[model samples]
Target: MAYSFPEEVLEHVFSFLRSDRDRNAVSLVCWSWYEIERWCRRRVFIGNCYAVSPEIVIRRFPKVRAVEMKGKPHFADFNLVPEGWGGYVQPWIRAMAASYPSLEEIRLKRMVVTDESLDLIARSFKHFKVLVLSSCEGFTTDGLASIAANCSNDSVARLRFSRTSNNVSTTKLLNLREIDLRESEVEDLSGHWLSHFPHNCTSLVSLNMSCLGSEVNFPALERLVGRCPNLRTLQLNRAVPLEKLPNLLHRAPQLVEFGTGAYSAEIRPDIYSNVAEAFSVCKQLRGLSGFWDVVPAYLPAMYSACAGITSLDLIYAAIQSPDLVKIISLCPHLQCLWVLDYIEDAGLEALAASCKDLQELRVFPSDPFEAEDNVALTEQGLVSVSEGCPKLQSVLYFCRQMSNAALITIARNRPEMVRFRLCIIEPQAPDYLTLEPLDTGFGAIVENCKELRRLSMSGLLTDRVFEYIGKHAKKLEMLSIAFAGDSDMGLHHVLSGCDSLRKLEIRDCPFGDKALLANAAKLETMRSLWMSSCLVSYGACKLLAQKMPRLNVEVIDERGHPNSRPENCPVEKLYIYRTVAGRRVDMPDFIWTMDKNAGSPEVL
Candidate 1:
């Protein structure tokens, strides 16, 4: 006989488990535990929207209230993916609307969301509160207006008022709480969406519209900010002028995170004092960003608010090293920083000396297409940060050159790195000091950093580097390669090893049919594989499609029909993923969907 816990006790235990991995493991314990876990689970995360159907998700987790779904490959942000490629959210929305009526949150990334889908969401979930669309596209302000006007209704307010008759004066009914649209591509159809919120609605806590390309109505925005007493995070687009920022700050002094919109204005004494005075009152501000078209004269106005900032983003601001050094000196508590390479090595050294609590750093190239090595940034900048910031764990550094010696030193200094992505601006760039492949440098990273989960390699590499990665990087989940590798052996080494690998992206490499067919079983365990401008052939793709019944192998040949070329001709691009939804129906004309059961290759 086995001792079993009571159902009540197990339910209590399951409520405390937060991660999806942990919760999934708990469900597989036994029959009773599976039933209890399914009933108690409230949140679900879908890494790839096409991997599983919405009906399957609803059937598995019947009581879920929140969902986070991602669509498109990571390289889609760089324009590698074509427009109208088919990551639509309408089907998922339609399915969930019929099942989960009490759903409160829907978070989507890199997906196409039309206005009709947004309209359906607003009319479907009565208790909807949060909508976060990051790096998504195919929606405009008209869709946003539907969300604002329809999310909270007057009937709910009246019911609340009737419930608390004596305390009606103090009670407020706000149904919606958050709308986060960071880094999303939204069309600015009109600026009147802010005016859609009801006068009594005071539920907004976080609002981010920083990615909008057009101006918004200023008066409506100011009023909305004034009424939302609980608003803590507010991000505005670059169209918001500098002069109007003072009034908004005065209205929302309780803000914990803010993005300064258009920090450029004429140098006037009154305006400068007002700006400084407004920032002096924001004692709770922690995260700051969005200094578009920043003027150096206006930088000092916000110095009083910089002492407590932990996350600072100046990627859009092209300030030189001297100004960057001055701003960094004031931020002693900075933990995460994103800036352009205009800061150079000098500014990073200053950052290393001052900010000891830093955990993450990203340096973007000021001008990626510039042929000359204009900026003074090099591997030395990263080495300095690693030497000074003992708690550093993640880095994304883009520079012109790197060396094996610097990487070895950095690896030794920070053995706790979880994500190390270094992109040399020039493709297939070699180590500047010795002019050799960067095999030893990246090999040192995988060997030393036992916890590395994501890696993007650059600077010349070869089969030797892949061998190092396959052997040592046991926990690596995502690997991005471009313009490197000697032959199919590089891909073979990776597929043979890396048990936990989920996503692999390759471009301009020499990998082809031999390595792919040799390890065909490995594709079943991974989430996705994207190869473009490589040596993979159409025949190998067709065979992979035929052999693996669960995988959907798609060939993107925009030049002409797949049958027009020889079977041995190399395909222009290949995208393979495991999917339970059969084949996507909305594929464009250029896409060639291989069928598993067809005797001959048929384009669907």
Candidate 2:
């Protein structure tokens, strides 16, 4: 406690504290507002890039310049963290190449990133501008042609790539605009890479390679969209079918985000009146994702771009329920809807009587191995979209059965639910009209959704619904349990009450080894802990890795040595986190690391 002012008036009151949670509450209000919010911190997210230690975020943000991390653990996109289970971004670009050498942008997700850490972040940040990567993998296209011939920072605009490797040939990109290569794995996205743009390249606005498999160069992508009339956004792939999507929607009818390509063809009524008269001359289309194989007689050719569509991704549309109630009864200002549980439950009750400004919904599972008696929507179509979408604030409903009066009438009609993922696909299935346990419909969702931050639970829970989610989820930060709970005091009453629990994902249930050592000192400030198939043992994960010697504690044996088995079996899978770059030189060979006196589980 010092400065009642000065230090340039506390860096001008922490430069209007641009929320990283109000500059982490004024750097916990002390130590001179934590050295003036660490000399005016500049963008740092790091949600588990080894949960802290790029030399402790370059010694706590000394003029940090945009970092946004995240690597492997989002259950490694459901393959469940296998292949060399570690997320490396070359030790945070060799610890921010000597502390953020004025690093610019570097957003990465589900990381692994190689090509020598993108050629040491293109020779370590000389005003390196933006490098976004998502669901990343070992880098390719020779590390994106060494970040397009060494990050020539004309403040590099955008270069989005999904699931890596499309091979960016050499480099040109003058003042590069945007090149989103979605779902990549390209060996050839049809011939001569659209003649490497630049026949007077009008700074291309946006060009998404919609999961290319082949077939491109349609007159060099319509002469680079007719010499880029500031091309808005065009995502094409699925080998661009349906008769080349009405000549690329009549040359990008001034597209404002349209990603449709292979929506099947052959039934010509002049291909649904020439693709609904080329999407009624686009009228600044507001966002519609690629409709691969979608053809319910061309769903009335997108009802003339559905009243200024506001985000509709049909997750690879499988269309049913009256062609998703005639394409969600013509959008009606839809606010984010991702479908394909083949839209049953009368297509989400005609999308809650036509999209009452619905704020996000996802329903995947088209036939993810179908049958929970052929699951279609339940809980009476999720209480008729929570009694007609009172602005539903985020959902990911994958249904089979549900009830407790339809989850207490969707927690009294969507009490501003911020991300509630209800996936009752017959696991621990209960509450179907009072079979009980779903403890008060998830204790009325953390006691009336007090701004819930991500919660995913299945049915038939107990230990009084993890003791009402550890006495009313104090703004719970991510919890996903499956097959509900019962003992180990429901994971020790959510590790002695959720004080903003970072992340915990359990599988199967009945947690073991005294509920995996009842959160020994709450797993070092929680950022990760995943249990699989439950009933933990191997001497309670070697006594919770000898009482959290700064937690890394992995144990995901597929089978083979937990020291040649029988330390009371039961440890099938567990993975704890919190690493300052210790033990993770890409540990694979059946992922087992935790060796206090190496009597067991070590082998890389």
**Candidate number of the best lDDT:** 1
lDDT string, candidate 2, 1-604, tens digits: 4665678877787778776878888788787788778877888887877656677677877778888888777866767666777777897798787777777677787787787987787666766556667667675555555554543324443454545677543332333355555553434524446655446555567777676566776887887787677788888877788767777778778888888878878788987888889899889988888788877787788788888888888787677778778878888889888887777788888889988998888887777666655545666776888789888888988877787777877988888888888887778888888798888988897888888888998878888889898898888888999777777899888888888887898888887888568667887888888888888878777777777777778888878667777777886678888777666656767777786554256664
TM-score, predicted candidate 2 vs. hidden true structure: 0.35
- RMSD in angstroms between candidate 1 and the native structure over all alpha carbons: 4.1
Q: lDDT at 361 for candidate 1?
A: 98
| Model 2: lowest-lDDT 10 consecutive positions | 167-176
Candidate 1: C-alpha lDDT: 0.89
- For model 1, the superposed segments whose C-alpha errors exceed 4 Å read 1-3, 151-174, 599-604
Backbone clash count, each prediction separately:
0, 1
